[model samples]
Target chain A: MGAEFVQFSLTPVLIGVLSAIACALPGNFLILRRQALIGDAISHVVLPGIVVAFLLTGMISAVPMLLGAAGAALVAVVLIEAVKRLGNIEPGAAMGAIFTSMFAAGVLILEQTDTSSVHLDVEHALMGNLESLVWLRAEGWHSLLDPSMLATLPGELSRIAAVCAFVVVATLMFWRWLKIATFDEGFAQALGIPSTALGLGLVVVAAIAAVAAFDAVGSIIVIAMFICPPAAARLMTNRLGHQVVWSAVFATLSAVLGYVLAGYGPFWFGFEGAVSAAGMIATVSGIILAGACVFGPHRSRVGVAQQEAR
Target chain B: MSRMAQPTIATDHGHSIDPARAPRDTALAIHGLTVSYGEKPAVFSVDAAFKAKGMSAIVGPNGAGKSTLLKAALGVIPRLSGEVYVFGETIRDARARVAYVPQSASVDWDFPTTVMDVVQMGLYRKVGLLGRLSGPVRAQARECLDRVGMADFANRQIGQLSGGQQQRVFLARALAQDADLYLLDEPFAGVDAATERAIIGVLKSLKDEGKAVVAVHHDLATVRDYFDHVFLINVRRIAEGPVETTFTTEHLQATYGGRLAATHLDELAVADGAR
Candidate 1:
């Protein structure tokens, strides 16, 4: 059991956890800034980015694909803003129009292109091949410390782990600025903080996270990880510091619990095959958010001490 | 234009002149400040100065660019052409000496932050990036809350606060800055009478301590009672000086234009007579 688990389940679960953390870290700020939909938009537009990268490079390598996705996200942001200002449309409507159009265009290109020769497909884009990315060379738990065995680990694992570490370090370094800017942008600018640049940086960081996670867990889980964890965490506390911690914990729990259930819950039900891990993970996060909404201590805005004082 | 306030002596560069009699230093000075949304100039070629040891009101009718002027001067909004000085130095050079309290409506009140957290934001510069909030800094933030009468509610989520209490929390944040020049936008809007009195009292105290307080004030009734000086504008600057000299019927009419109804004109006339 131990050797088989290390070979098949460990890397996918680790990737899910790292991806959830990467996306959820920035989601906390995005939710407070009322830009939660940005994650959804970026993930949708990433399809076009990867498609274009594949077309350009005639390959499906990670670096070019990530760059293409980041580029697409940047383009989507600019296009959304332009449509908002020039068309005088509301932000939500603008984002909806742009991301859907870009995603449709991506699907069209993907269908027209000769991508069958490659491992890429629409299903794979929506539901990543998490099960296929197993540690084929691993023998047991001891494979973790064996440098020779570790060298054969899946590329997606290392990429996501590095991105997750990057996101964590960036959050710590810019915690104060992010807090103030998210709370009050005018005051942040007054204090000479480059708030607009910071806002753009946040979107870029979020785009990077989405693209990296998209490579491992698919866009559906990426979107869920971005919003559900942070939103659930928000209901858990009135303090941002506490909210962030709760989000991370919730994200990890969803990744682990969802992975386990998706892999083994079928056997208990007398089923033949396991369900999709990516779908299971997204569903679990949604369940967590719904639970937080219903039962989290700070869920309601009314009946708080400050409101009662009034 | 000739009666443009006693403290604001227009130099060739439109900077304030230090007259010996007033013995007041210019805390904020704006020269030829023009801001526009598209082609319609919101604030056109306006020159104004606010001095330390006093409270000044920027009075104007709706859409008169009173907020625009402040936002433009502070570089919060882009300007067509202007220069702003804080404590006789460029605003960029004197940012540490400046504090801004944007309209309460400008921020998301439901953001997950406590009163103490918002106040501590004022000390962000002092705290520096990558540095944690030290105990002394937190104590100072608490003191600012106490001054605003929100000490007991330090841990209270900001959204749960009433409008007046929220305004006080914003004030506490500004107070924590310990700024030399304070710029506030509609600090009294949606606030109760008690909050109004408490806020004005704080501004007066700041003025007494030789700090400069500038606010975009909408309530015409309280302009005279609440401000030491007034700068009136309607797209273009109308009149500015000590409230006694500048808050005149002629200037008020020009600032309000036809927007000031005859009824309000009568009220102003009555108020002017009472004054």
Candidate 2:
């Protein structure tokens, strides 16, 4: 049982947790800034980005895919602003229109192109093949110490780990700036924070996180992790620092619990096949958010009626 | 009510300040400042100078470009044409010497932040990136918050505060900046009387400390009581000088135009006469 767990579940679970943390770190700021949907927009447009990257590079390498998705996200942000100004539409509407259209273009391109030869498809993009990334050479926990065996682990795990470390460092280095800008942009600007550039940098970071995580656990987990854990953590605490920490905890919890349930719960129910780990992780995050809404300490406004009376 | 009756330098067409008083003591000066949106000009060729150690008010009616003038002068918004100087130098060179307070409604009040956190942001430039908040720095922030009567609410989330308290918190943040020239937009708008008094008291103290205070003021009744100098504008600079001289009925009429009812104008004119 331990060997099977190490071989099949360990790498995917680690990847899932890392991906969740990567997306949720930026998600806290996005949620506070009321730009949570930016994650949804970026994730949706990533399909087209990767498709374009595949076509241009004639390969499915990680670096080219990441660059392509980041470029697409930048284009989407500019296009959304252009549409909002030129078409005189609200931001949400502009975002919805652009992302959906871009996603549709991605689907059309996917259909027109001959991608059957590769592991690229709409289903695979939406729901990653996490289960297939098994550590075949591992012979229990001892394999972790063996460098040769460790090198045999799935590349997705290391990619996500690197991205997760990058996101964590970036978050810590700019923690004060992000907090100030998210709370009061004008005040931040007055203090020489370069608030507009910082705001764009946040979106770019969020896009990078989404693209990296999506490569591992697919878009379902990416979008869910980007919003749910942060939102739940927001309901748990009044302080930004506490909320960010809570979000990381919630994200880690969701990934581990969801992966275990998806992989083993079906057998417990006497079923034959396992469920999709990506979908299950997203569902677990949603459940956590729902629970926070019901019972979190700071779930509701402090004093709406009293305020109105005053 | 004569524009020429003022003792210091004053201009009719708004530009061309006396070159003698042009340097050193001027807190902020705008030359031929114009800002337009699409086709219509919001602020047109405005030229004005605010001096140090004085409390100045920018007064105008709605849509009068009062806010725009402050924003353009501070380089917060792009200006079509203008030169803005802070203490005789470009704002970039004197950035640390200047501080600004936007309207209370400018930021999302429900943001997850405490009063102390917001105040500490004022010290961000000094703290630098990655620097820890030393005890002295935290003490300075606490002192600023205490000035605005928000010391006890340091850990309280901003959304829990009233409109007045929120304004006070913003004032505390500006105070933490410890700036030489403070620019505020509608500091008194929608604030409680206690908060208003507390804010004015702080502004007065800042003035006494030899710092300059510039605000886009809406309440004309308090202009005489609160500010020593007033700049009246309606897209263009109508008049600007001491409150006793520049803030007159004629200038108010020119600034508000038909927006001020005849009866209200009479009341204001009567008030002016009484003063």
The deviation in Å at residue B67 for candidate 2 is 1.7
Where is model 1 more than 4 Å wrong at Cα? A303-307, B1-24, B266-275
What candidate 2 gets wrong by more than 4 Å, as runs, is A304-310, B1-22, B269-275
- What docking grade applies to model 1? medium
Residue B185 miss distance in model 1 (angstroms):
0.7
Whole-model lDDT, model 1: 0.89
Error of 2 at B212 (Å): 0.7
True contacts kept of 2: 0.55
| Residue-pair clashes per candidate | 1, 0
DockQ of each: 0.68, 0.48
